[model samples]
Target: FQISLPSLKERVQDIPVLAKHFVAVFADKTNKAALEITDDYLAALKQYTWPGNIRELKNIIERSVILEEAGKLTTDTLPFEITHTQETGNLSSFDLALVEKQHIKKVLNYTKGNKTETARLLNIGLTTLYRKLEE
Candidate 1:
């Protein structure tokens, strides 16, 4: 007998639960303490179409867990493709600079104004981060 499952996008509610489970599993594997996922992170996961289904979600969550530094899974750890595609309809402009500024602010908020960690999470040099802040 065969049983079929729905795509992750079709079951949006499950995204958070699955993400939490994956974070726990990966965190344990990496010998890290329990990690908590932020609501925004979960929202982003749910916003994605999940073309690769559950396996894709699992991979993304594992990647997030491994890359996480603040002991919490925030959208800063998510790939640009994923975070960039989320709810762009609400944006007033598609200009790269505006998007970058907004993204920097979001990461800063996630880091609780910790510029060093924000730069680290954004994968930019501390000097570059300050430069962007000046812009």
Candidate 2:
């Protein structure tokens, strides 16, 4: 019996459910308190292309569960690749400036407006972050 499943990107509606399930599994495996999945986190998962599919999702959730000390799964726990993928919706054209601005803003939000952390997450020096913010 040959069975085939569609890629995660083709099953957007399933993202939230699978993510929540993985969160539960990982939380249990890590022996952590019950973790709540934020709507924004689910939204971010849905937005990602998920090239690595279920295995990738599982790994991400496990990492988030282990790193999250607050008992809540949030976008801040997600990797830069997944989080940054949300900036551009249309793949046909790329707007470097707009995407960069949006990415900076998102990273800033993730860091709770902590410029130093944001700069670190963005891989930019503090001065560079300030310059880009000013632009």
Candidate 3:
């Protein structure tokens, strides 16, 4: 009988078990018995949205195991976007636009709102920057 498992995002709660299984399989294949996952690491995995699901998780684990010097996995070992998502949740397009506006405002502030300098720093034309601010 062929039983197809659901995607990882559809079964995010299974990450820990899957991670453990992968670790065991990898450890056996590499003849490295000292490797083990930490609770913190698993928690981070659970918190992630896993847009790419199990395949992405598997690739990340494999990459981490291959590159990690120690047997332990830390949140730092995960990709930056994962951490960003965990901290900020998923940002909407409006949120992104706000961030960009804030950044432009900061740069302008630093230049004392000098359009020419702000545009130069931002690598945009003064007229374009003005138009953007108006929008």
Using TM-score, give the best candidate's number.
2
Model 3 misplaced regions, further than 4 Å: 1-5, 91-135
Which digits, one per residue and each the tens of the lDDT, describe model 2 over residues 43-120? 889888988999999999998998786879888788766776645454545577766876898779768899999999
Q: What is the TM-score of each candidate against the true structure?
A: 0.67, 0.68, 0.57
Instruction: Please tell me which model should have the higher TM-score, number 2 or number 3.
Output: 2
Local accuracy by lDDT, each model: 0.85, 0.84, 0.73
In model 3, the clashing pairs are none
Worst 10 residues of 2 by lDDT: 85-94
Instruction: Evaluate residue 85 in candidate 3 and report its C-alpha lDDT on the 0 to 100 scale.
Output: 61
Model 1 agreement with the true structure over 1-135: per-residue lDDT tens digits: 999988888999988788888888899999999998888898888888888999999999889988888799898888766776644643343568767987899789778999999999999999999999899
lDDT at 16, model 2 = 83
